[model samples]
Target: MDHIFFFYFAAVIAGTSVLVVALRNPVYSALALLIMFFHVAGLYVTLHAEFLAAVQIVVYAGAILVLYLFVVMLLSIRSEERYHNQLPVAGLLGVTLCTEVLLLLIQSRTAPAVPRGSAEAAAETGNTEMIGEALYSTYLFPFEVASLILLVAMIGAIILAKKDIIETTE
Candidate 1:
C-alpha cells in the first residue's frame, strides 16, 4: 500500500537524518546525509513529483554530498579532533532547536486537503510538464535569481578551496 511505502521512506529519512547529526566522523556523517537525501527523493516520488525527486538526487545527493566529502577530506583531521569538546554544546543546541520545531508542529493544525486538479487531468499532462510551464512562465525571474545565487556560491567555494591549496604550497 502507499501508506506502507510512505512510512518506510519516512523512517529511513528520519533515521539517517539523526545519524547524520549524531556521527562523530565527518565522513560517516556525510554518508548518512547522502542516505537521508536519497530517502527524501523517495518521498518525492511517493508524492508523484518525479522531477523533484530527480533534482533532489542529482543536486543534493550527487553534487552537494560530493562537495561535502571534498571539504571534509581537505580539512586537517587533527584540527577536527580539537573540536570534539564542542560537541556537547552543539548537541544541546540541536536538542533545543528540535524541541522548538516539535512544539511548533504540534501547535500547527493541518489544513483540509484541497485538490488542485483531477488525477486524470494531471496524468494526461504530466507533472514535470506542468511544473516546467509554470516555472518558466510565472516564476522565471525568481528561478533565474536562485540560479545566479547558486552560481556565485559555487564560485566562492572554489576560490576559497584554491586559496587553501595556494597557501599550503607557498
Candidate 2:
C-alpha cells in the first residue's frame, strides 16, 4: 500500500521533471517544475518526514518557483528563442553521463553501509527537531551564509529587472 503511493509519487516527479526540460516555453517549463516539486514533497511525506515535506513545498514549490516565473516573465523571451535547440551537444553529454552512471551502478558489488546511530535517541527526536538542532548548533554559519547568498540573488534579480526597464525607457 505504501509502496504503491511512493512509486506513484516518484513516477509523477520523474515525468514532470522530463516535461520541465522538454517544454520549450519557459513559463510551461516552470509550471512543470512546480509539479515536480510538489510530487517530491509528497515523496518526503511518504518517508515520514512531515517537516521536510512542508519545507519542500514552501521553500521550493512556493518561493523558488514563483521567483522562476518572475524571471521568465521579466525576460520576455521570444518563441524563436524558446524553440532553439541545443540538443545535439546536450544530448550527447547527457547520454555519456547516463552511461557512466549505469556502468558505475553495475560495477558496484557491495551494498552501501548505513551509519551506526543510536536508534533510541532518534526515536525520541522527531525529524524536524533533529534537523533544526543540527542546523542551528552544528551548521549555523553555513546555514546563515546560504541565507545571505539567497538575499544577494534576490537583490541581483531586482537589479537586472530594473536595468531592463531603464534600458527600454531610454
Candidate 3:
C-alpha cells in the first residue's frame, strides 16, 4: 500500500513538473507549476516534515503561484505569438535541468539516509526551545539580515506595482 502510494505521487510530481516546462502557453505552464509545487509539498509530507510541507504550500503554492497568476493575467499572455522560435532554447534548458537532476540522483543514491528523531520525541525535548537555541546561537546574524532583505524586496515590489500618472498641463 505504501509503495503504491509513493509510486503514484512520484508519477504525478514528475508529470506536472515536465508539463510546467513543456506547455507553450504561459498560463497553462503556471498552472502546471502550481500543481508541481503541491506535489512537492506532498513529498515533504511523506518524509514526515510537516512544517516544511505547510510552508511549501503556503509560500510556494499560495503566495508565489498567486504572484505568477497575477502577472500572467496582467500581461494577458494567452498565446506564444510573441515568442521568437524559443523552442530550441527551451530544449537546451530542459536538457541542462535533466542533467543536473541526474547528477543529484546519482549523488543521493550513494549517500546513506540519516535517521530523524520522531516528532513525539522532538516535542518532548522542546521543539521551540531547540529551534530558538540553534537560530540565536549559530545563525542569528544571517537570519536577521535575510529578514531585512525580504522586507526591502516587499517594499520594492509594492512600489513597482503602483500605477504611474502622467499630467499634461499647458
lDDT (CA) per prediction? 0.87, 0.86, 0.82
Count clashing pairs, candidate 2: 0
What TM-score would candidate 2 get against the native?
0.78
TM-score of 1: 0.76
For residue 150, give model 1's deviation from the true position in Å. Answer: 2.7
Task: Please give the distance, in angstroms, between residue 159's alpha carbon in candidate 1 and its true position after superposition.
Answer: 3.6
Candidate 1 lDDT over 80-116, as tens digits, reads: 4454687789989989999999987876667555667
Clashes of each: 0, 0, 0
In what order do the candidates fall by lDDT, top score first? 1, 2, 3
1-170 per-residue lDDT for model 2 (tens digits): 99899889989988998888788787899899998988888888877778999999999988888988887788897544544377688889999999999888887757676688777987788989999999999999999999999999988878785657767777
Clashing pairs in 1: none
Candidate 3, residue 142: how far the Cα is off, in Å: 2.2
TM-score for each predicted model, relative to the true structure: 0.76, 0.78, 0.71
Kindly give the stretch of ten consecutive residues in candidate 1 with the minimal lDDT sum.
75-84
Backbone clashes, candidate 1: 0
